[model samples]
Target: MQDEEQDRPLLGRTVGITAERKAAEIGAALPRRGAEVRDGAAMHTVPVPQDGELRTATESVLAAPVDRVVVVTGAGFRGWLEAAEHHGLADRLVEQLTGAELLARGAKARGAIRGAGLVESWTSPAEESAEVLERLLAEDLRGQRIAVQLHGEPMRAFRDALAEAGAEVLPVRVYRWTDPEDLSALDALIDEIIAGRIDALPLTSAPAAANLLGRAERTGRGEQLRGALREGVFLACVGPVTAAPIAAAELPYAMPDRARTGALVRLVADRFARD
Candidate 1:
């Protein structure tokens, strides 16, 4: 019994998960380390490949030659191409993008661009949208037609900043983040967090973190949730981008040196084991 407990570092710990796409994978991983996993997907990714909004955006991009293109996320960039292919504009769209200066926000986006046979002229070292914006702002973007691939939500501020810099910005929203179909699980998870029943909460994306915080605020337990997080519950974020919301709320969190899910899992296990 003593040996088993030593091997299972998280034997007495309960961890909450807020990922929709990778929930099963993460849930399975935590249990292997002896954690009681609580699954509560806070947001859902709704693909808009065939939607009118995406089509219109695609059309606008193809209407004229774009001078620059910003790839924000790998999935979003891939989905945008898939949507273009659905509209029979894949070949032409690819040709047009190939001629433009491509800027990838991170490694994932860079990989997606390379997979599509497109080369990125620049890649952000920090893997942040803010860094992408800063790079664009440094250049004189007067009269430049730029297309920005949005990930899961509209980046109004990002687009607005570009427009302010005298560039015509076109936003391609390949998908949007919506509340999960069932809120019971998420609500229950929130309750558990507020009551300090959960030891740690792991977040995979910015939208999920934002949605969780938004839900708590809507239920008038925002302060309670923040207090609980500050007092007892350990918050683990996958990466800096995913940790933005928590930072905005003035909450402390732990992030792995690498942004991969496996690294995140190890970070959680090691943290608990050390504690």
Candidate 2:
């Protein structure tokens, strides 16, 4: 599986991934490694957002004069606005979004928010929720009202920290990462793994890994197959949340000092070359 062509170069190499649009950046990076890209939407095609909660949360934000609004994910950015648009609240959402202190958790998220004509007051240190919250805590949130947008799950610590700092925190759950409704995509992901077609894997989230593993299990070759795939393949994770599922599965994996995609790709490129 060592294609020295892609050893340090990473070209002529293919990493089976399911990240939707983010995959473009990931794919573009591989060419620097001399890698050609292969698509596997089952791997992690980004989830389409369902914004029932976002509507309620945005209304809450408009209701109160909030001090800051933290948006967590790029998907949330598009989804929130789309949700607002659907309900004839696009203009209102934009106005409200701009009114408060706007914080973004990742580069893509920040980019999306800024593209919408709102500047981020605070951009998180890294993609991790805790890191975003840590940066927020450094600010004087005391006696201030803040609204946080949740991607999938509640960030207990982030919310608790705001409360501890004497600030009122409102949670807006904009979207959810759902279990794959279409098993065909799941099946193909398993096939790629079993075939050892994935040279290197970059995991952005635990759910993506779990989804692949689940697909493997359904095919009745989960253990026997993943063992072989794990051999020739390098598994890289962006951060703790992304790495946890691999550790839980007791699989060998690597995580970078920083969770950004740049860091993740660099770690993958450098380590594979070194090994």
Candidate 3:
């Protein structure tokens, strides 16, 4: 089977990748399947400096042990830890958090917490902030102090829910999302999709999907581009979070059973086979 599969099923097919951190790996996955890959890194992650919002949140958490702590993303947690380490407070921060009732949003967060030599009291099965809030609300959190490490964008709804339940929430944004320095490449990709020069586009995050559509709208090609995607261009997302904006736009898309990059590639390959 390995010998037969070497034929590169993606040959003559074109797919787009919108991830920055894992662009090389994801880009490589497509060509192996015989598909032409387009790099569509929509945004980059920028860590907040030591004297930024994260530092303030760190000071507050270290001042006193929080009643409950929520970790939203593994990468964000690692970034926070690195920042704390730089300030020579990594050990203290870890010690303080270990005393709190640690909660994780998903497997990734749980892994990060465990990697830091701490244990989580529980983790949200849904792997999202809304679900995390749900699990936390199930407890008697009135007047409890909760510290949240936001991955990138602020999860305002999750924070608001905690406040409504009378929990003192310290929401810390450890990083920010900035648009790609050059979107000319993205614009060119858009032109290819609209012109039927491309076959599929896989989006790993919601922001990239939203920004792609936003760009099309700004260039007055929204309808034309949307039409192409809905009709022929295969729009594949890693999972629901990435698919949410695409769904909201009423565009048709495909997602694998698991939200992994390998699964996404297999999904596209299988999709082409079925058609």
Candidate 4:
């Protein structure tokens, strides 16, 4: 059975994975079906610099139980726990959140919350943060204290919206998705993509896709790269969020109906098999 499975269609194809947090796991999944994974880690996850900003937020949450807590991303949720652990307050923070109404932007955040032994009071449909805020606004939120786990990008609009609805919002920005500190290998990967050296690319986040294109654009090879993607190279994104930039660029790509890692991989495998 193992040998038969190893003889799968992707046996000699090269797949590029640009995920950061679970880069290894994504890469590992590709090989089981026989695809060689190229490490295209354009971004790295880093806890918000040891600056007191993150600590202060966690402290505030513990000081007074927030009326409602909104978790934006799984990565952000995990990052918060990690940062709190550094301050020896992970357990306390988790305990403190028990009394608050927890909301998740998507399944990812819900997963993180559950992993921490916390239950989410609700989750937004379509995994959109805006939907979560909109749903909360329909109800009475006057004087409600809400804590939001920010995921890298600035969501001033989200904060402002909550405030307009009469909710005091406290943003707990735990970590950011930043470009890799070292650019030594990025150029090579771009070159390979242009040269058609890679067969497929799996993007797990919008930022990673944007960063990859930004780097290519800086090198004056953006058009060529896009052409490559449109012509032969397969670009597979985890979901609509990750596919948004690719779509905006007018590039052709494939994505599964559900934004899950396994589905993304299967979509890629199916694409390769058809070709």
Candidate 5:
């Protein structure tokens, strides 16, 4: 504790993490290195219902005329299929997935689609909604209907972009994150961000950024959070792919050359001196 305090006087800089897992691996990386991490990781382990609305949704999509399907979240695809399996819909679901042209938002989404014995026709260059829209615009889907699997929060812009390009876009909202039933940790993190008591954030996912912003709004710190991002907090996303959310914040951000955690840490150390 003493070493951390001495090493990171910028302990004043408190950054928060809202990751899928406990962020045990990445949480330890931020301390005393000039960044104080707010271990507000809400593990994205919401049980994929063995059978429920999710299964019904999956069955609905499977039964629909899916000419092309876009897999945005790898975990979402797995959860969706898992839910369907409990209802004895895996074989048919697999069959439904067979003929559609698969579009992957990035490596993670691609992994999920391939795991289902499928593959992507094109993977988003930047693993973001904007990039995905650009890819679709270039594909000439004048009248074809495309299925976009919703990842976390709904991206209205993504669907709108596809529709503008003359493609009938059908979105599948498979899974979404809810704040940890206990909101104290999340609350404190938002407070720190609003106060600009943070130098950098180790952003893990787009939803993390969205969720933080949402929380700030609920607590009446929306402007405060945005200001912190612009004037104080230096966001360091895991990869260029992961930079989308920060960029969407319209806040200045720094990202690593590659989509790797080690690279992100190194990039931070290289650019910012130990304060």
Candidate 6:
């Protein structure tokens, strides 16, 4: 029994996941590697209520030729195009986008652009929005119309920067993040983390990380959670973007070289094996 346990590094360990989209997928992977899984989706993702807002933005983008288009996430980019198709504007939108410079924030975004039969002018080397913004700011963008596809949340700073640079900004909000329908599971996971029962946590998105920390603060367990994290709770983030909130909290976390979910799972397994 001891020898077999040695072969499975994650055996007997518990890992908590807070992503709603692929919680089941990630949860299954952890158990296969011998770790117990706890699924507590911190937030839920819903398509932007098609209440004309998205259509209005689409129409605006098609109103004139855009100088640049920013793709922030693969799913969001795909969703935006689908929404456009529903409004009978997908083909036109794609044609307009093809004429402009496309900036992809990461590999997934790049893939989405290519899948749409469009090529990105450049992809951020760090897969960070900050890097994307930096690249745009370095250019002269006055009087340029730019469209930015938003993921689950608004990129206020990124949009503001472009607008300040004298460019007309059109934000395409494909989806929005909302609190989970059921808070019980998330609350229970919070309890487990505070009690140090969860050995590690694997976070896939920045919204999930922020939502987790926000929930802890709301429940008056923020300090306790921070203490537990500092004391030795392992945090495995998919990438730096997902680690931002945790990093701002001055907590330590490990990130995979690549930002894919599979890489994140492998990172967790490798860390436990090393320990």
On residues 52-145, what C-alpha lDDT tens digit does candidate 5 reach at each position?
A: 6566567667767777887877888887777777788888878887878888877888998888888678887766556667767787877877
Question: Whole-model lDDT, candidate 3?
Answer: 0.83
Candidate 4: the clashing residue pairs are none
The sequence of per-residue lDDT tens digits that candidate 1 reaches over residues 1-275 is 87766688899999999999889889999999999998889999999758699999998999999999999989889999998888899999999999999999889999999999999999988677778999999999999999999888576778999999999999998998899887899999999999889999988889999999999999898999999999898899987778889999999999987677888898888888886
Candidate 6 residue-wise lDDT, 161-208, digit = tens: 999999999999888898887789999999999998999899988888
Two-way TM-score contest, 4 vs 6, winner: 6
Tens digits of per-residue lDDT for model 4 on 13-87? Answer: 888777777687788888988898777677776778755889998888887768999998887899899888888
lDDT of 2 by residue, 1-275 (tens): 55654454665556766564467888788677766566554443332344455677768777868888888887777777887788788897788777787878878789989888888887777667767777778878888888887766456667998999999888877655655556676566566667877688887766677766766777797896579556877889888766766787888888888888888888777865654
Top-scoring candidate (lDDT): 1
Q: Report RMSD (Å) for each prediction in the order shown.
A: 2.6, 4.2, 2.9, 4.0, 4.4, 2.5
TM-score of each: 0.87, 0.73, 0.85, 0.78, 0.77, 0.88
Better of 2 and 6 by TM-score: 6
Regions of candidate 6 where Cα sits further than 4 Å from its true position: 1-7, 124-131, 164-166
Top TM-score hit:
6
Q: Is candidate 1 or 3 superior in TM-score?
A: 1
For model 4 the TM-score comes to 0.78
Give the CA lDDT, 0 to 100, for residue 230 in model 3: 94
lDDT score at residue 103, model 6, on the 0-100 scale: 96
C-alpha lDDT of all candidate models, in order: 0.90, 0.73, 0.83, 0.83, 0.71, 0.89
